[model samples]
Target: MQIRVSIFLKEKIQNPNGHFVLQTSGPVPYGFEVPGLIRYFNAKGQEVRRTRFPSGGNYTSALRQGSFDLSGDRVTILGTNMYNTPSSQEMDPSTTSNSTRKQKQADTTPNPLATEELNLLAKLMGGMEVQKILNVDAGFKVNLLALEQEEEGM
Candidate 1:
Protein backbone atom coordinates (compact mmCIF):
# COMPACT_ATOMS: atom_id res chain seq x y z
CA MET A 1 0.00 0.00 0.00
CA GLN A 2 1.11 3.57 -0.64
CA ILE A 3 0.13 6.86 0.94
CA ARG A 4 0.21 10.18 -0.83
CA VAL A 5 1.60 12.76 1.59
CA SER A 6 2.45 16.38 0.99
CA ILE A 7 4.27 18.55 3.49
CA PHE A 8 4.67 22.30 3.28
CA LEU A 9 5.86 24.89 5.77
CA LYS A 10 4.02 28.17 6.14
CA GLU A 11 3.63 30.77 8.80
CA LYS A 12 0.68 30.55 11.16
CA ILE A 13 -0.93 33.51 9.49
CA GLN A 14 -0.67 31.88 6.08
CA ASN A 15 -2.91 29.12 7.39
CA PRO A 16 -5.27 30.77 9.81
CA ASN A 17 -8.10 28.28 9.50
CA GLY A 18 -5.49 25.50 9.55
CA HIS A 19 -7.30 23.50 6.93
CA PHE A 20 -4.30 22.25 4.93
CA VAL A 21 -4.18 18.62 5.92
CA LEU A 22 -2.93 15.31 4.53
CA GLN A 23 -4.58 11.93 4.80
CA THR A 24 -4.08 8.42 3.39
CA SER A 25 -6.36 5.40 3.25
CA GLY A 26 -4.21 3.83 5.94
CA PRO A 27 -3.13 5.36 9.22
CA VAL A 28 -0.47 7.87 8.16
CA PRO A 29 -0.51 10.76 10.62
CA TYR A 30 0.90 8.59 13.35
CA GLY A 31 4.13 9.72 15.09
CA PHE A 32 4.10 13.22 13.61
CA GLU A 33 4.23 16.45 15.62
CA VAL A 34 2.45 19.78 15.40
CA PRO A 35 3.42 22.46 17.90
CA GLY A 36 0.25 24.45 17.48
CA LEU A 37 -3.26 23.54 16.39
CA ILE A 38 -3.78 21.98 12.96
CA ARG A 39 -6.82 20.46 11.31
CA TYR A 40 -6.19 17.14 9.60
CA PHE A 41 -9.08 16.04 7.43
CA ASN A 42 -10.32 12.69 6.21
CA ALA A 43 -11.53 11.93 2.69
CA LYS A 44 -14.77 13.62 3.72
CA GLY A 45 -12.89 16.65 5.06
CA GLN A 46 -13.21 15.95 8.77
CA GLU A 47 -10.70 17.04 11.38
CA VAL A 48 -8.06 14.52 12.39
CA ARG A 49 -4.90 15.53 14.27
CA ARG A 50 -5.01 19.15 15.35
CA THR A 51 -1.21 19.39 15.49
CA ARG A 52 1.48 17.99 13.14
CA PHE A 53 5.20 17.73 12.91
CA PRO A 54 6.70 20.77 11.26
CA SER A 55 10.11 19.20 11.57
CA GLY A 56 10.46 15.59 10.39
CA GLY A 57 12.91 13.06 11.77
CA ASN A 58 13.53 9.35 12.25
CA TYR A 59 15.03 8.89 15.75
CA THR A 60 12.90 11.21 17.92
CA SER A 61 9.42 9.91 17.06
CA ALA A 62 8.03 13.45 17.30
CA LEU A 63 8.82 16.87 15.81
CA ARG A 64 7.52 20.42 16.36
CA GLN A 65 6.47 22.71 13.61
CA GLY A 66 7.76 26.26 13.26
CA SER A 67 5.51 29.12 14.26
CA PHE A 68 5.28 32.75 13.26
CA ASP A 69 2.74 35.44 14.10
CA LEU A 70 1.81 37.88 11.37
CA SER A 71 1.88 40.74 13.83
CA GLY A 72 5.62 40.26 14.38
CA ASP A 73 6.32 41.59 10.85
CA ARG A 74 9.45 39.40 10.64
CA VAL A 75 9.34 35.64 10.82
CA THR A 76 11.41 33.23 8.84
CA ILE A 77 11.83 29.46 8.77
CA LEU A 78 15.43 28.88 7.74
CA GLY A 79 18.02 26.12 7.48
CA THR A 80 16.12 23.34 5.78
CA ASN A 81 12.36 23.52 6.25
CA MET A 82 12.23 19.89 7.39
CA TYR A 83 14.24 17.93 9.92
CA ASN A 84 14.64 14.16 10.36
CA THR A 85 16.77 11.63 12.19
CA PRO A 86 18.83 8.95 10.47
CA SER A 87 17.42 5.45 10.24
CA SER A 88 18.80 2.95 12.73
CA GLN A 89 20.52 0.98 9.99
CA GLU A 90 22.23 3.99 8.45
CA MET A 91 25.83 3.76 9.53
CA ASP A 92 28.08 6.76 10.00
CA PRO A 93 30.61 6.58 7.20
CA SER A 94 33.01 8.97 8.86
CA THR A 95 33.37 6.63 11.82
CA THR A 96 33.51 3.45 9.76
CA SER A 97 36.07 4.87 7.30
CA ASN A 98 35.90 1.64 5.26
CA SER A 99 32.98 1.90 2.88
CA THR A 100 33.92 -1.28 1.00
CA ARG A 101 34.02 -3.27 4.22
CA LYS A 102 30.65 -1.99 5.30
CA GLN A 103 29.14 -2.81 1.91
CA LYS A 104 30.46 -6.34 1.99
CA GLN A 105 29.14 -6.89 5.51
CA ALA A 106 25.76 -5.50 4.63
CA ASP A 107 25.51 -7.75 1.58
CA THR A 108 26.46 -10.84 3.54
CA THR A 109 24.11 -10.31 6.43
CA PRO A 110 20.89 -8.46 5.65
CA ASN A 111 19.36 -7.68 8.99
CA PRO A 112 15.65 -8.37 8.97
CA LEU A 113 13.37 -6.04 10.88
CA ALA A 114 12.23 -7.70 14.06
CA THR A 115 8.59 -7.67 15.15
CA GLU A 116 9.46 -5.22 17.91
CA GLU A 117 11.10 -2.93 15.37
CA LEU A 118 8.03 -2.94 13.18
CA ASN A 119 5.81 -2.25 16.17
CA LEU A 120 8.00 0.64 17.28
CA LEU A 121 7.87 2.11 13.79
CA ALA A 122 4.10 1.75 13.75
CA LYS A 123 3.86 3.42 17.13
CA LEU A 124 6.09 6.27 16.00
CA MET A 125 4.04 6.79 12.87
CA GLY A 126 0.80 6.58 14.83
CA GLY A 127 2.01 8.96 17.50
CA MET A 128 3.60 11.54 15.22
CA GLU A 129 1.60 10.99 12.03
CA VAL A 130 4.87 10.98 10.11
CA GLN A 131 3.28 10.00 6.81
CA LYS A 132 0.57 12.65 6.98
CA ILE A 133 3.13 15.45 7.28
CA LEU A 134 6.04 13.75 5.53
CA ASN A 135 7.20 15.08 2.15
CA VAL A 136 6.05 12.29 -0.10
CA ASP A 137 7.72 13.84 -3.11
CA ALA A 138 11.07 13.33 -1.47
CA GLY A 139 10.22 10.02 0.12
CA PHE A 140 11.53 6.88 -1.53
CA LYS A 141 10.25 3.32 -1.60
CA VAL A 142 12.10 0.40 -0.04
CA ASN A 143 11.87 -3.23 -1.14
CA LEU A 144 12.57 -5.42 1.86
CA LEU A 145 12.88 -8.55 -0.26
CA ALA A 146 15.59 -6.96 -2.35
CA LEU A 147 17.69 -6.74 0.77
CA GLU A 148 17.46 -10.50 1.32
CA GLN A 149 18.91 -13.39 -0.59
CA GLU A 150 16.75 -16.14 -2.14
CA GLU A 151 17.42 -19.69 -1.17
CA GLU A 152 18.44 -22.02 -4.01
CA GLY A 153 16.94 -25.22 -2.52
CA MET A 154 13.75 -24.90 -0.45
Candidate 2:
Protein backbone atom coordinates (compact mmCIF):
# COMPACT_ATOMS: atom_id res chain seq x y z
CA MET A 1 0.00 0.00 0.00
CA GLN A 2 1.14 3.52 -0.83
CA ILE A 3 1.43 5.93 2.05
CA ARG A 4 1.54 9.71 1.77
CA VAL A 5 4.27 11.41 3.81
CA SER A 6 4.90 15.08 4.40
CA ILE A 7 8.13 16.40 5.84
CA PHE A 8 8.39 19.86 7.35
CA LEU A 9 11.36 21.70 8.85
CA LYS A 10 9.95 22.54 12.24
CA GLU A 11 12.82 24.46 13.88
CA LYS A 12 16.52 24.48 14.51
CA ILE A 13 17.47 23.68 18.06
CA GLN A 14 20.74 24.67 19.68
CA ASN A 15 22.51 21.60 20.94
CA PRO A 16 25.93 20.07 21.03
CA ASN A 17 25.31 18.52 17.61
CA GLY A 18 23.44 21.53 16.16
CA HIS A 19 20.36 19.43 15.64
CA PHE A 20 17.52 20.45 13.37
CA VAL A 21 14.15 18.80 13.85
CA LEU A 22 12.06 17.82 10.86
CA GLN A 23 8.47 16.84 11.51
CA THR A 24 6.95 14.13 9.36
CA SER A 25 3.28 13.33 9.39
CA GLY A 26 0.82 11.58 7.10
CA PRO A 27 -1.55 8.66 6.78
CA VAL A 28 0.11 5.35 7.60
CA PRO A 29 -0.83 1.96 6.25
CA TYR A 30 -1.15 -1.03 8.53
CA GLY A 31 2.12 -2.79 9.22
CA PHE A 32 4.02 -0.05 7.42
CA GLU A 33 7.78 -0.08 7.49
CA VAL A 34 9.59 2.08 10.02
CA PRO A 35 12.86 3.98 9.93
CA GLY A 36 12.59 5.10 6.30
CA LEU A 37 15.23 7.20 4.55
CA ILE A 38 14.91 10.93 4.10
CA ARG A 39 16.87 12.48 1.23
CA TYR A 40 17.84 16.12 1.05
CA PHE A 41 18.30 18.04 -2.19
CA ASN A 42 19.76 21.41 -2.97
CA ALA A 43 18.32 24.14 -5.16
CA LYS A 44 20.19 22.65 -8.13
CA GLY A 45 18.20 19.43 -7.67
CA GLN A 46 21.22 17.48 -6.57
CA GLU A 47 21.16 14.97 -3.74
CA VAL A 48 23.35 16.39 -0.99
CA ARG A 49 22.72 13.99 1.86
CA ARG A 50 20.44 11.27 3.18
CA THR A 51 19.52 10.34 6.76
CA ARG A 52 17.59 7.45 8.24
CA PHE A 53 14.79 7.88 10.72
CA PRO A 54 15.16 6.68 14.31
CA SER A 55 14.71 2.93 14.70
CA GLY A 56 11.40 2.14 16.30
CA GLY A 57 8.43 -0.22 16.01
CA ASN A 58 6.51 1.92 13.51
CA TYR A 59 6.93 4.79 11.07
CA THR A 60 5.51 7.34 13.51
CA SER A 61 7.93 6.16 16.16
CA ALA A 62 10.90 6.81 13.91
CA LEU A 63 9.48 10.08 12.67
CA ARG A 64 9.31 11.45 16.20
CA GLN A 65 13.11 11.42 16.36
CA GLY A 66 13.65 13.15 13.02
CA SER A 67 16.58 15.32 13.99
CA PHE A 68 19.51 16.11 11.70
CA ASP A 69 22.64 18.25 11.67
CA LEU A 70 22.19 19.40 8.10
CA SER A 71 22.40 23.14 7.50
CA GLY A 72 21.08 24.93 4.42
CA ASP A 73 19.04 27.98 3.53
CA ARG A 74 16.79 26.00 1.23
CA VAL A 75 16.25 22.27 1.04
CA THR A 76 13.94 19.72 -0.56
CA ILE A 77 13.12 16.44 1.17
CA LEU A 78 11.83 13.22 -0.32
CA GLY A 79 10.71 9.93 1.16
CA THR A 80 10.79 6.56 -0.52
CA ASN A 81 8.07 5.99 -3.13
CA MET A 82 7.18 9.66 -2.90
CA TYR A 83 8.02 9.87 -6.60
CA ASN A 84 8.66 7.31 -9.29
CA THR A 85 12.31 8.37 -9.36
CA PRO A 86 14.48 10.74 -7.38
CA SER A 87 14.81 14.20 -8.95
CA SER A 88 18.54 14.42 -8.12
CA GLN A 89 19.69 11.68 -10.50
CA GLU A 90 22.23 13.18 -12.85
CA MET A 91 21.29 13.34 -16.51
CA ASP A 92 23.30 11.29 -18.98
CA PRO A 93 25.32 13.79 -21.00
CA SER A 94 25.61 11.28 -23.87
CA THR A 95 21.83 11.16 -24.23
CA THR A 96 21.64 14.93 -24.72
CA SER A 97 22.76 16.61 -27.92
CA ASN A 98 25.27 19.47 -28.03
CA SER A 99 22.54 22.13 -28.40
CA THR A 100 20.95 21.19 -25.09
CA ARG A 101 24.31 21.40 -23.32
CA LYS A 102 24.98 24.79 -24.88
CA GLN A 103 21.65 26.16 -23.68
CA LYS A 104 22.27 24.84 -20.18
CA GLN A 105 25.78 26.28 -20.12
CA ALA A 106 24.47 29.71 -21.09
CA ASP A 107 22.00 29.65 -18.19
CA THR A 108 24.49 28.31 -15.65
CA THR A 109 26.61 31.45 -15.48
CA PRO A 110 26.11 32.90 -11.99
CA ASN A 111 25.26 36.60 -11.65
CA PRO A 112 27.73 38.57 -9.60
CA LEU A 113 25.14 40.88 -8.10
CA ALA A 114 22.02 38.95 -7.24
CA THR A 115 18.99 40.90 -6.08
CA GLU A 116 19.02 39.27 -2.68
CA GLU A 117 22.69 40.12 -2.14
CA LEU A 118 22.10 43.71 -3.25
CA ASN A 119 19.22 44.00 -0.78
CA LEU A 120 21.44 42.67 2.00
CA LEU A 121 24.20 45.13 1.15
CA ALA A 122 21.70 47.99 1.14
CA LYS A 123 20.39 46.95 4.54
CA LEU A 124 23.91 46.73 5.93
CA MET A 125 24.90 50.16 4.60
CA GLY A 126 21.63 51.89 5.52
CA GLY A 127 19.72 54.37 3.30
CA MET A 128 21.84 57.49 3.94
CA GLU A 129 25.12 55.67 3.48
CA VAL A 130 23.92 54.10 0.28
CA GLN A 131 22.85 57.50 -1.08
CA LYS A 132 26.25 58.93 -0.21
CA ILE A 133 28.07 56.02 -1.80
CA LEU A 134 26.00 56.37 -4.96
CA ASN A 135 26.86 60.12 -5.09
CA VAL A 136 23.20 61.10 -5.11
CA ASP A 137 22.98 64.89 -5.12
CA ALA A 138 20.40 66.15 -2.64
CA GLY A 139 20.33 69.56 -4.36
CA PHE A 140 19.49 72.39 -2.01
CA LYS A 141 18.35 75.72 -3.48
CA VAL A 142 17.50 78.87 -1.47
CA ASN A 143 14.12 80.48 -2.22
CA LEU A 144 14.57 84.23 -2.83
CA LEU A 145 10.97 85.07 -1.83
CA ALA A 146 11.20 83.19 1.45
CA LEU A 147 14.53 84.74 2.27
CA GLU A 148 13.15 88.26 1.57
CA GLN A 149 10.09 87.58 3.76
CA GLU A 150 12.29 86.25 6.60
CA GLU A 151 14.54 89.41 6.43
CA GLU A 152 11.46 91.74 6.47
CA GLY A 153 9.95 89.90 9.46
CA MET A 154 13.26 90.12 11.30
**Best prediction by lDDT:** 2
List ranges where model 1 is wrong by over 4 Å. Answer: 1-108, 113-115, 127-154
Candidate 2 global CA lDDT score: 0.42
Worst ten in a row by lDDT for model 1? 69-78
- Tens-digit per-residue lDDT, 102-124, candidate 2: 65457656565564465556556
CA lDDT of each prediction against the hidden true structure:
0.37, 0.42
- How much does each candidate deviate from the true structure in C-alpha RMSD? 21.7, 20.1
Candidate 2 wrongly placed segments (more than 4 Å)? 1-90, 109-117, 121-154
Please state the error at residue 92 of candidate 2 in Å: 2.2
TM-score against native, each model:
0.14, 0.20
Worst 10 residues of 2 by lDDT: 66-75
Q: Highest TM-score: which candidate?
A: 2
